[model samples]
Target chain A: NAGVTQTPKFRILKIGQSMTLQCTQDMNHNYMYWYRQDPGMGLKLIYYSVGAGITDKGEVPNGYNVSRSTTEDFPLRLELAAPSQTSVYFCASSTGVGETQYFGPGTRLLVL
Target chain B: AQSVTQPDIHITVSEGASLELRCNYSYGATPYLFWYVQSPGQGLQLLLKYFSGDTLVQGIKGFEAEFKRSQSSFNLRKPSVHWSDAAEYFCAVGAWSPDKVIFGPGTSLSVIP
Candidate 1:
């Protein structure tokens, strides 16, 4: 299985530009999550979905939005990119809350 | 709220030497703990996790962690270090219920010959 997959391994966006980061999992997990990791720092949760059509905000969800249309897909949307949003974004999935999370390769974003 | 802390920013150890990475967490109840390793420019990979059962948990790559509830610490240890083990390690904590998993800053390990 692909475990988890993300698109556009790397991207560079200008301020105010918008983009969508796609994430897909083939493990049929019920829980999915979006997180960002800054240089020399740990990951911070941006958003998560318990299942299809159900999503919720995470610790740092201010500049991001997410939609889970199918159990295999969860996409994060950035309405207006900023310098602070320049970081590596990771998508993860798990069978349940507090369970082991399988992570994707991550998308490196640079906002200029 | 749950939080995790890794006291050491970076550590260096000679090949075949013992290694240890410290982690501390704060939460109201018993937390689900995890240790992950990330190579440069790569994604995080789970090394091990602690839910209940025994306090000592074994992980991949000859790594193990001991959970100490009294000190709120879950420290990762390896009997012998390898050059390939050089990477950034992160400790994370989560609640039993639906909650965000909190990750520590991370500890960068460097293995020397």
Candidate 2:
């Protein structure tokens, strides 16, 4: 099974351009999260979903938005890309709270 | 707010030498601790985790960690280092409900032959 899959492994966007980073998991996990990793920094949570139709902002969710319409999908949207938004983004899922998370390869974004 | 810290930004070791990566955390009550490794160009993978019971926890790839509550530390250790073990290691702290995790800046390991 494809544990967690993210689309567009690499992307380049212009300032003010919008795009969505897609994430899917076949494991049927109830908890999903989006995180970004900058150079020399630990992963920072952008958003998280408890279940379908339930979402919440995380530590760093300023320039992003997320929606969970189905259990297998949680997509993060960047409304207006900026240089600061350029980073490696990861998607993770787990069966429940306190469970070990499975991470996707990661999407590297560059805003020009 | 809960947080994790990896003191070493990078560590280099001769192959077959002992290795340790330090991790310190700040949290109230009991903490669930975890270690994850990321190979270059690869996603992160779980190494081990500590919730309760024994303070010493064994993990994959001949790695282990000791959770010291009094010191608020969970440091990863290996008896002998392998070249294949070179990767970035991260320490994380979390709980059961709410399931929010805080990750520390990773420690990159390099093994020289």
Candidate 3:
């Protein structure tokens, strides 16, 4: 099964531009998460969903939003892109709490 | 609050030499630990995880980690290093709560011939 997949491997956005990063998992995981990684740094959680129709903010959720309409999809939305938002975004899914997470090949965003 | 830290930012070892990457975590209770590897321009891959049972946990790619509760540390080790082992390693700590996982700054490994 395809563990997790993300769209638009790379993107460049101008200031104030908005976009949605797509993530999908076929493993029927109950938990989905969005994280961002800066150069030479670890990942910081942006948002997560425990299940369909339930989403919550994570550590660095100031500039992002998320929705979990179905168990297979969790999308992150950026209302206004900024330079600080330029980072590698990863989407992950897990069976439950404290379970192993399967990660997608991240999307690299560049805000100019 | 849960947090993780990798003391060494980068480490270099010759091929066939022993290797170890240190990780420390802070949590109020017993924490679930994980180690992940990331090759350049690639996604993260789980090397191993420590949930319960034996303190010494074995992982993929000939890697193993020992969880020391008293020290609040989980260190990854490999008996013999190979060039293919060169990658960035991240240590993470989490609990039963959703979105509570915390990742440490990765430690980059360089294998020399």
Candidate 4:
């Protein structure tokens, strides 16, 4: 299985710009999550979905949005990028919450 | 509230030496603990996990962890360290069914030859 995959491995965005980070998982996991990791800091949850058509806010949800249109896809949208949004974004999915979350290669975004 | 802590920000060990990375967590009940390794510029990879039963769980890459409920700790240990083992290690804890995990700040492991 391919596990989890994320697109746009690296990107640069100006303040107020917008973009979407694509995430897809070959495993039919019901739960998907988005997290951002800052330098010398732990990963912070941005958003998550238990299944298709279900989404919820997480620890750091500001300046971000997420949609779970299908069991395999959960994309994170940066709708007004800010300097704070510049960090490594990771997409993970699991069979259920608090299970072993398989992570994709992170996306590094720089907001200037 | 659930949280994880890797008290040591960085650890250095000579090749072939034993290594231990500390991890402590805060939660109300029995927690699902995990250890993950992240290579530079990559995503987090699961090293091992603890749900119940065996407190000491063996993971990939000769990594093992001991979960101590009294101390609220789940420390990762490797008997012999290799240069390739240099990476950031993260500790996380939470349980299933209306629970979410929180990760530690991460401990960067450096192996000297």
Candidate 1, pairs of clashing residues: none
Task: For candidate 3, give the DockQ.
Answer: 0.80
TM-score of each: 0.97, 0.97, 0.97, 0.97
Query: Rank by DockQ, descending?
Result: 3, 1, 4, 2
Q: In model 4, state the lDDT of residue B86.
A: 94
Per residue, candidate 3 scores C-alpha lDDT tens digits across B4-105 of 889999999999999999999999898899999999888899999999999999999999999999999999999999999999999999988877789999
Give the per-residue lDDT digits (tens) of candidate 4, residues B30-74: 888899999988899999998899899999999999999999999
Model 3 CA lDDT for position B46: 97
lDDT of 2 by residue, A1-112 (tens): 9899999899999999999999999998999999999977899989999999999988899999999999999999999999999999999999888789899999999999
Clashing pairs in 4: none
Instruction: Name model 4 segments beyond 4 Å from true.
Output: B97-99
Quality of candidate 4 docking, DockQ:
0.73
Candidate scoring better on lDDT of 2 and 4: 2
Chain B TM-scores per candidate, in order, are 0.96, 0.96, 0.97, 0.95
**Every prediction: chain A TM-score:** 0.98, 0.99, 0.98, 0.98
Give the range of the ten consecutive residues with the poorest summed lDDT in model 2 chain B: B93-102
Task: Put down candidate 3 lDDT per residue, A9-88, tens digits, no spaces.
Answer: 99999999999999999999999999999866799999999999999989899989898999999999999999999999
Off by over 4 Å in 1: none
